[model samples]
Target: MEKYDYEQLVICQDKESGLKAIIAIHDTTLGPALGGTRMWTYASEGAAIEDALRLAKGMTYKNAAAGLNLGGGKTVIIGDPKKDKNEAMFRAFGRYIQGLNGRYITAEDVGTTVEDMDIIHEETNYVAGISPAFGSSGNPSPVTAYGVYKGIKASAKEVFGTDILAGKKVAIQGVGSVAYTLCEYLHDEGAQLIVTDINEEAVQRAVDAFGARAVGLDEIYSVDCDIYAPCALGATLNDQTIPKLNAKIVAGAANNQLELDKHGDLLHQKGILYAPDFVINAGGVINIADELNGYNRERAMKHVDKIYDNLETVFAISKRDNIPTYIAAERMAEERIASLRNSRSTFLQNEHHVISRR
Candidate 1:
């Protein structure tokens, strides 16, 4: 076993139902872990484990950078969401969450919907991103898209010396959920759009709504544009696709965009400014974090809009220091987390180990 490189990971299997699941809680840099639950028909348990662990880690940084009190975590149910789901499966999963106490919290993500979240909520209080009717702020995809929009502006400022996105060619690789909302922002900014998605209806919607040109889902690589926005699934920027990109800046809301970790260096070498995905896509989590009662929409949007400030700073840092934007952003996030942790140790030395996760 590779023993997940993650800070904490627990794989579960319900004895009676033979249901398999993996819960990965990356880091509680800011507070107790929180993120979404994903159900997929992964080919292997190991693959499911890897995805959960990696996504959970992304959540940690995502929440920390967004200035949210919650930490990052993720759950993966390995089976078909349509056919393999049932009350027992979710309850069995809920029991797993109960075992973790409050170390990790789970909500809706990908294959998991609000109705599914309702099921898990019955077992524990460690949940977020629930429907507003259930006393939550509701789905976070729109806010996620909003954050990406702000990030796009920041990327433009770094690459073009202006936040105005008007007339800039933007290639969006997906049209689902966040992508549609993101396109609205891009269209309002007067950006030229070249969009694609595996779903035909979504592609048509983009073309009809924004006068955006539709490209084949797999052909996003060949599109000539000023920016490449991947709002779809992960691992899209691999060795094969990176070589085909015509865009100068790659900014998107999808998690784990780089197919391989080394792809960051590849983008840098290619002179393509890569906005860190976790940083750019922190909007959803930021919005969901508001369910803590006394939550304010205005305050959440303010934080979502703050992506521009953080990214603008990262752009400044990268340009001044001549470093890759991704590297610069990650370094900045790590420094902020370390500084917070250090302050706690200095003031509350005895509580150091309690707050710090080695």
Candidate 2:
């Protein structure tokens, strides 16, 4: 293992905003780190740290798997985006990025919106997910959903031997941006949809838009469907929930779906085809990563549309290696990132001496 793999991750916290930000520049070989700026009210600094580190690492694998020329890094603002965000707080975050120079780039994710990125942009040049006016491809959730749609097709092929998507029952666990878009795709495919979300408005939107059956958050584990897609949060399926899943496949835009490492094996044992969360949901990152140069909305979309190919490769690798699909996908992505880092070691600082570079 590379020393980078074991290196202590760097993080900067702003006390005034109670922002416990982390920059897990998983690999800087390709370029400065680029990921999202997700704002959430974590219970504690320790919880925030855990989330930032895990999410940053997932970004690394996501970009690598998508073959993007960027690294993985993420920031977590410890406040409610709906009510707690202010200009001063974002500006403070910008200062943190400025201090890091160009090593870690930030964008919008989960709790944070594109408008938030615009605020962060005021403080530093190291920001993506800026508004369209700022010459950025904003709100990558739709593209992320596109990738998940394609991935669902690939998973369908592996499990059902077809990607036609029609008549497939897909239970979406969240009606957020990406999941909503995924529902749109599934709706077009004539898939029977079951959707759930903590947000009532989002659930109603699903009801109005696609006639998706609204399931309660507590009942998600019991939904009888061909595919149980957990798009809301991570670790939706664990020891208890996994046993209750009637879905033959589990794939969605949620990050770090496995609560623990052992959960991967649990899914494998249950014969449920699992597409790694980061791999399937990488469409958004792939799109934003495209904006570093000339913004080509069409070209960026084409890259995202290629999620089918990635899904196929992951599925094939899983079968060929007789390993869990999630592990197979992660290994594939890790190997690709390792290769890129090795190729660029001569140009980057501290890269040659420390393989544990993350």
Candidate 3:
């Protein structure tokens, strides 16, 4: 697969800490590449590289759609987060990030935390989402969930002629941190929830807290609901899951929801209104982007609430162009990045050479 098309890819290894990592930068036409560092244990190095490339590209679209003057980059550590994380390892990873200068900035992602970012920050100033005491946003999941909720409402408005989520049935594929917060919002709005997670404890917690009905992991796709929210991982909306979904709308915080580009058109042909994953799940980046200036929870949330309006714009573009929502969102992001690229065609090199053109 021609995954080598990335702008830059760095393979990092630290023998002392037994650390192995990959950082992929997809584009920087808008500005510096910004994304989160994710730690995962993959079956092979190739799998990890593929994931880093895909996620980095997703970040590019996410930043563009969120109207942030940033490009896309991502880091993946080839080890288990629960067992392999330590101060030395992340610090080593940080030194590698520091070597990149400011061309790529990282926060936290799956298997990474704010505390981990703090460790990385000890070695580099090119990190965001450190800690509130460090004048940065701590955790971005709540805002991410908030954006997904707003996107779901936007899709509801397109499908049901109203944005109200009251009495709507939402089948959640995962009840993790972000989805847990999302359940609170949907429950408060009077929406019924059906949750499923590989972690039975997480599913039980959602049932206890939100009165959500727990379902088997395999059954989440076929559940009779108004919306299907895949908050866990990528590629859940694939050939196997799409035909089984009974929901009228698909909106969630998961990145790369579609296994392939063709799956987006499949959803469209099925008459399902889909709120593109990157555009809908951009609240986290929007929140973290605010930390670039200085953390302001109030201002950041106020900006995140704009996801509702952005989804409306995506829907409008989809209707106008007679295309799937995913394609429409990508087109919008590409258009913005293109305009910014032209307006920013000057070379502004820092003395440290932290930001440079390869």
Number of the top TM-score candidate: 3
lDDT by residue (1-358, candidate 3, tens digit) is 2543579999999999989999999998888999999999999999999899999999999999998889999999999999988899999999999999899999999999999999999999999988888888789998899989888888899899998999999999988899999999999999999999999999999999999999998999998999999999889989999999999999998889999999999999999989999999999999999988777889988888888888899999999989999999999999998787665554333433554442
| Clash pairs (backbone) in predicted model 3 | none
Give the per-residue lDDT of model 1 (tens digit) for 1-358: 2453356889899867657988887777677888898989998888898788888877877777677777778888888888988877787788889889989878789898877877778887777776677768778889999999999988888889888999999999989999999999999989999999889999999999999999887788878899999988999999889999999899998888998778988998899999989889988888888777545789889888899888887777888898877778777777777887888777787567667865
Q: Is candidate 2 or candidate 3 better by TM-score?
A: 3
Q: Per TM-score, what order, best first?
A: 3, 1, 2
**What tens digits encode model 2's per-residue C-alpha lDDT throughout 152-221?**
9988998998888888888889888889889989999899999889999999999999988998887877
What stretches of model 1 exceed 4 Å from their correct place? Answer: 1-5, 15-18, 348-358
Worst 10 contiguous positions by lDDT, candidate 3: 346-355
Candidates 1 and 3 compared by TM-score, better number: 3
Error of 1 at 252 (Å): 0.9
Clashes of each: 0, 9, 0
Query: What is the overall TM-score of model 1 with all chains considered together?
Result: 0.92
Model 2 compared with the native: what TM-score? 0.91
Q: At residue 244, what lDDT does model 2 achieve?
A: 83
